[model samples]
Target: MEMEKYFRVDKLPHIWCPGCGHGSVMMSIVKGIDKMGWDPEKVTVVSGIGCSSRAPGYMNFNTLHTVHGRPIAFATGIKLANPELHVIVITGDGDGAAIGGNHLIHACRRNIGINVVLFNNQIYGMTSGQYSPMTPEGSMATTSPYGNIEPPFDLCELTRSAGANFVARGTVYHLPKLDSYIEKAFGKEGFSYVEAISQCPTYYGRRNKMKTPLEMLEWQKKNSIDIKKARDLDSEQLKGKIITGIFAERDDEEYTARYDQLIKSVQGGKE
Candidate 1:
């Protein structure tokens, strides 16, 4: 199967800054789709407004570039309309967790069959480097010259609590592992969430003195731990660290699957 056939170059060159991790995450998504050998006509990529949201435009499959922080809503509608289609929502930290946070939680609670690839760069790369909800406290950003005052949300914990059927996290530096997690997410029957810890060198790098995109990537490589071994670490050692791998998974009926069963039962009433 030719992978290039599913890409759309007219939207290029991509808007992401040089050496941005979004490109790496995008490649993982493409690789996962290619591995699945999914029919392009049966796949729909949806996104909200942000650098990461532009991802759907680069794909030749059915795409929707919706308003900021609304990709989940659009994806839900699309999936409910035709549960057979593979619906993927590509969103950034700000788009998925900040402004669109409510939608994210509700979608997970619904247990809908949709795949969400969250590009977590930690800061608001777009909109001029503000402190996003995922930005680590004490991390410097354009808006937080001194340091970010608020704590960052643990995305994995949040999703798991919201009832997501599958939750995983991987960084751009861990491409092989990231690809595997994404592939698993695609196969899940209910809401599947994969958080890609990406780097934003142009903005986040300059603020943190990482200076270069490669340096940021190296930082992630050193700071992240495989989830399987995370339990061995002491609390102090694990603080401010990221655990990467499949964190939670459960096999259960999706929203539509349960609904279909209910409809059939009602239609075949014995009374």
Candidate 2:
């Protein structure tokens, strides 16, 4: 496929640091969207304040770069107004799981028709280097000079448990499969989520001793375990491994459709 069709050429030269995994992940998203053959004008991209949020600006779509941690709320409104639109949210670990955690949970619980692609780099890259909700325990950051003491949130597990119709996990290293997951999410009728494990070489890497982006990617390649492979291994064998794969899929009536039905019933067929 000619990649130019999927991007806004004027937005070339993205601001993400060199060797950062965000570029590959963004490409995978566009590839997935292209495969789905959704009309560009009908696709809406929403995002909160973060590095990942910058993606919507680079894409040729109806994009909304919203306030910190509130993209889902705004997206909910958009979906309510026009259920036909394909709404996708681009968020970071800090933006989605910290300040916006409440909204994320409610979005999953409501099973709204929106695809959330969480770019989890494990730290607040946009703000220099603060520890985020997905930062692994004992990882170093500017906020956690010694090591991060808080436990990380497993996004897929959380979303699946919260009733999202579909949830999947993938790393930038597994980009082709990541594209597949995004495509699957976009096709689902209810709330869907894909957590794209990204690498932040500029901030997270420098603070965490991953001197170069390649080193961080190498570590990811070595530590990540496919969910299928993980099931075969005992807990002891899987210690400290990153599990990547589809974690859940359910067919639920989307919130917008159900709400419309309720309104019709309440109005007794009146306008």
Candidate 3:
């Protein structure tokens, strides 16, 4: 765990609000990359505008901070233009599941070689506590004073159904499990998605009466059940519970590899 090697030391002290779980989730990403032994020079991190998108600013690697909800698109292009590069996308609930949602689905359908780590704070924390696509029904937010009537998207299940080669979910409170999911996602040959459930104490907590970050973290611990144990429970028993674990993983033809084969066929092996 020589973290300095993977972080921009000059960027010491991030700007995330106190009690935010994003920092932990961001560290898990770095740990995954380090454990995989991937050369930083060959890795590229892309992000869209949001609290989570700031990760690339501290990461010591080829990085791109893109427009809101479009990091996946930018990452896909980078991967296609030079298939040798390992691309990772850091996006948030509002940035990924709302505006950039279509891009997320298509990337999964294409099964591209990119790792998408979504930091789901359940609210648009960067945008001043607005409700996001991942905000739970009946949740309070700047945009949902009367409680959010819309159901939240189960991002892991969405990606799994959309053809992602690997899909998983974990909470910031469960750091080791989160890190393991990310590491596994990085090792997949095709499109992989990991939803890191993060706490937004300043915005989400203050609005929902959680009072403190510790309370939010405790809520996650009490509500989350491993995917293995979840199977033994009925739907009623699982209600309001966060199921954390890998949902899908399969050996499939990756987008870049398939594109390369098509190019070879079209040019008789000449680039």
Candidate 4:
């Protein structure tokens, strides 16, 4: 199937700012979809309010551009209504981890069969640069003129703890590896979470003096460690480190699977 057939060019010249890593993420998703050989009609992409949210509009599939911080809820509904469709949620740091945090946690806890691609640019790119929940401590943002006073949430750890069946972390610079992770997530049967550490060159880059998107990419490359190596690092050595790769995975009953079992048991009791 021709990949271009799945794109909506009217939304052309995507809304993402120049040098934004969100573009890389968009490409990775497209590539993953193609590699999976998924039928576009059988797939649905949902997003909330953010640069990442605009992604669903550009894709030629069943799409939902929902309210801010609610893509997970929408995705959940769509998946429950038609469990056979491959549902993917595109969300940003603020939209997913901050305001939408409750939904994110519940989705993971339910082990719903949905693939969530979380774009973690650290700062809120669409809201004129406020510090997001994943923004590192001491990082400058519009809200943090001096620097952020609080520590950031480790997204991978949060999702894993919430009981997501699959959890992984990757950056735009690691596109090849990220594509593989995304494919794995799509193939997984239960809640699959990917925190894609991306760059917001316009806001996050300028404020932090990362200056350009390339510089931010370089930072990610330098700071990120393979999961295996990260596990071996002592606390002191692991400071300021970003671990990339699949952190946790397990094969367990998905939400629908458990539901089916309950129905069967109830039917047997009735008989």
Q: Pick the candidate with the highest lDDT.
A: 3
lDDT per residue for candidate 1 within 119-142, as digits (tens), equals 999988878798899988789998
Tens digits of lDDT, candidate 3, 175-247:
9999999999999999999999999999999999897999999999999999999999998898778999999
Per-residue accuracy of model 4 over 1-271 as CA lDDT, tens digit each: 4646788877788888888999889888888888889999998999999888888888999999999999999998888878889999999999999889999999999999999999999988987899988898889999999999998888899999999999999999988999999999988999999989999989998998899989999999999999998888897787667889998799877987777678889899564
Candidate 4: clashing pairs of residues: none
Q: How good is model 4 by TM-score?
A: 0.96
TM-score of each model, paired residue for residue:
0.96, 0.96, 0.97, 0.96
The TM-score obtained by model 2 is 0.96
Off by over 4 Å in 4: 268-271
lDDT per residue (tens digit) for residues 110-133 in model 2: 999999999989989988989998
Error of 2 at 218 (Å): 1.1
Residue 228 lDDT (model 1): 78
Better of 1 and 3 by TM-score: 3
Candidate 2 vs 3: which has more TM-score:
3
TM-score, cand. 1? 0.96
Q: For candidate 3, list the clashing residue pairs, or say none.
A: none
Ten residues in sequence with the least summed lDDT for candidate 3: 1-10
